[model samples]
Target chain A: MTKAKVYHDGAVSGARRAVDAVMTVLLAALCIVWIYPVFLILINSLKAETAISTTSVFELPTAASFVGLGNYIYGITKLNFLSSFCYSLIITVTSVVLILLCCSMCGWYITRVPGIFSQAMYLLCVFSMVVPFQMVMFTLSKTADSLRLNTPFNIAIIYLGFGAGLAVFMFTGFMKSVPIAVEEAAMIDGCNALQIFFRIVFPILKPTMISTAILETMWVWNDYLLPTLVLDIKKYRTIPMAIQYFRGSYGKVEMGPMMACIMITVLPIIIMYLFCQKYIIEGVIAGAVKG
Target chain B: MEKAIKKYWPVFLLPTFAAFVIGFIWPFLWGIYLSFHKFVTVSKTTFVGLDNYFSVFSDPTFVSAFWFTAKFTIVSTILINVLAFALALMLTRGLKGTNVFRTVFFLPNLIGGIVLGYIWQILLNGILTNLGLPLLALDAKYGFWGLIILMCWQQIGYMMIIYIAGLQNVPGDLIEAASIDGATSMQTLFKVKLPMVMPSVTICTFLTLTNSFKLFDQNLSLTGGEPAKASQMLALNIYDTIFSRSGAQWKGIGQAKAVIFFLLVVAIALVQLYFTRRKEVQQ
Candidate 1:
């Protein structure tokens, strides 16, 4: 019986090892496939415009085809890539900060003060989440125009409104989990409502706040439709909008410069992601779980 | 405390309330009103009752777009969830370099939809050309599958993270008990592991369902509903109808389509939540 058991154990262990080896190889191959498309663009971004189209885009840039920063220069000077990048940065930062501050305060009030009005406000914010942007695109554009919200700086206000649903929802959900005694104790010590919120409650809500900030930043940064409709496109463009217009313009697309601009646009986000990857992953999971 | 908080309610809530009114509330109400009126612009309007809604039903393109979006959403949501769940299972097995792999997979999700669409457009076109097949723009089927692939690429990682969280929370004692009772690997997975991960499954499904339904940027930049608008999803269809159409009546018709689309999403989401929430086992 002992010998038979030993043989069976050996067989199972061998099979497990084989499965592990196969899975590792399979995952490695998939990783390559996932990364290849982006890599292809990066390499092609350096080639001369003539070579970009004449040869397969998969081919490496040769000595003859290498222009070396030529595309970057053209993208910045002619394609308005720099201005769009600056606009994207400004809008994302401003919108994220505004949403975080405004929604957190609103979320706290509604959660702490129980009443018909607060309940209705909370429900409305939740309801807004499911409403598709296309449902309001036309009227929204018109509204933005009338309100003079056609600039990047002012566009943050629009983001706050549209973003309030998710932000307030997440914030209130997190707030409910917080211990009420902490706030009450602070209040008893004579800290004003604003002081207690900013000095005490806000610190405890840091994780959720970070998560909210990251979520809003990602949305506002990558958002193409809202800004495209709300902003004066002639005067200001987000990175995605600029990329679309550049590719959509008449005649043959300057693939080299376009790819360069894409690289420039994607690099900063990737770097930020790498630095705070843990928080981003945590934030996404937290946000989804609450959502 | 209540009085203190109430006295400062204007400070606490007004910014968000004011913005929400401007951003969502007014636009939402205006959109519904516009659906009942004929207008070249917001200011130019004439009340037309149910005429615009009637025109939406008659537009074959809008109807076809609805069906197309439905099929795409079903396929992509299933693909993304299943693959993401499988990946989560594999990565949670104490594997080497799992974190690195997770990060790599999640990278695509960070890229914007428009950029994702254009990148996939070029790549798919290249591969299809090499394979002697029609480019993505030339064939509706290719666009459909291309969008699915792009969506899975972007979403699977996100869902995987959620699934991973769910998977890690599965009580180890339960798995050990099942194994000690001689439960097979397949049996443990199906009977034990899956039941515990249903919450993540619910969240992932809700996300994928809504996202695939509301997809616009990718649909626009990828194929732009080429080949006579065969592949246009509802959102893109509504956009084209509102903006690209010349007649003033098309705007209201598009608005009606938007209302219908909104209702369809809300109904589906509620039903999904109802069913999925029922299946979740309370810890």
Candidate 2:
């Protein structure tokens, strides 16, 4: 796959090796550039509020400038970080779980049963995926409020509604590719459709289930606009909403605590990526390819 | 099994369908209906004909927002795909730490847009200030370029990963045959590699196009369309029109804008789908 070969004669392998070496260094530098802003936030988070001024932004925290965990402490207390984290956690987990379970069942049913009803449902789900949130935001929030789905606990149903399209699409795509021979055997063995699905087909769906879960988690966790619109912000706040509130009220931003809040908001997702990167990447690929 | 399972529809399909009705179908139809009416609230809405759309079209900020979003989408999509493809080409080469490079590049994508926006704001504002230039929000041009830069950084890794997968699937034997036929690298890339990765191109371009058009969170946090809303994209423009204003007229206009935006997306998605299907037929 190396293009260096096409650039050189038969005896230029050493030159190609050097070219590869140089390219490696260039990529490494680009990687540093890629990761620099986050690193900058980390350093500035530890700096004293006074020392994190624009001129001194890139400088490492000196003894006089360092505040250790002070900004984190301030951010936790003032930004209301912990409760927001709890809210975000609840909303994301509940939404992802609900979407995966309901959509998987729905996906299985629609594919297995052939009818106009199934086809229409499938088309609607697919159509909803491309409709931008703006189209639905005004009425969605109003509907959620009226239905009392505006709370953190019940908002997952809304997530279920919004997320069903992609989940069902991916699920049905995989479901169609799975042969029905085993399912038929289970049917012959006196297993009802429910039993075979729960005991047999569900297990076969673990890979897709995992990927779907990851995609949903990444979305619902970091989502800002939906929760803000759907939930009564006075009563509930997700991490992104809280972050918006941190600097949202006034443009006279509080740099120190804002930095802490940014770090807090990003930390868990970064840790999760480090641990489950392969799954996350693959899941993203699956999600993207669905369109 | 199909016969038996069909009887159990209530157990499996009912819940999702119910939620889908409540969550998507109801809102979608209601949104479309609301777009044409002037409403302070749903109960207070009055049928306004095309009055809301008239307001939307006449508003200069909304008009500029459409053009700005169009320009931003075009520039960012081109830049992101080109750079991402280059990075994919580089990273796909057998090299030490390729995995590490790929990991680092892909990390920012997992982080939320609002967080990514603030991170860049801090860095960009700090640098601009140190250099005695206008901060990101202070000038529309700076805000424009700031968004361009941020979008590139955030999306390149994601598009690169897709492009890598595409490149990897381009069948090694074809490449070998090209080289054996005395084809240079550029020729191989344009004729063989590029044609083969058309699927990836289609997906990547589709994603980047729609995402760039539909962008909200990053644009909101990064610039908030400051300097008199000169930098607001269509999404943010719709948001501010509905949320920031105190009157029913703006809400109706916002809803109208949303409808227009939705139609635009559906049209583009359909066109892309048509091209992809045609390609599949040829292949």
- The collision pairs in model 1 are none
Best by DockQ: 2
On a 0 to 1 TM-score scale, where does candidate 1 land against the true structure? 0.97
**Could you tell me the lDDT of residue A127 within candidate 2?**
93
TM-score of chain A of 2: 0.95
For model 2, the docking class works out as: medium
Cα error, candidate 1, residue A232 (Å): 1.2
Give the lDDT of residue A144 in candidate 2. 91
What ranges in model 2 sit over 4 Å off? A2-10, B276-283
Compute each candidate's TM-score over C-alphas. 0.97, 0.97
lDDT of 2 by residue, B1-283 (tens): 6789999999999999999999999999999898889888789888999988888889999999999999999999999999999999888778899999999998888888888888888899899999999888889999998999999999999999999998887777788789888887789899888888888888998999899999999999999898899999999999999989886588888999999999999898889767865664123
Which interface RMSD does candidate 1 score?
Answer: 4.4
Model 2 chain A poorest ten-residue lDDT run: A2-11
**Per-residue alpha-carbon lDDT of candidate 1 for residues A1-291, written as tens digits (9 for 90 to 100):** 112223336788688668877887888899999988888888888999999752287788999999999999999998878999999999999999999999999999999888998898899999999999999888888989898998999989999989999999999999998888988888899988899889988898899998998898889999999998888788898999999997677898988998999889888878989999999999999899999
Q: Estimate, for each residue in B44-155, the C-alpha lDDT of model 1 and write its tens digit.
A: 8999999999999999999999999999999999999999999998888766788888998899999999999988887888888877798888899999999999999999
Off by over 4 Å in 1: A1-10
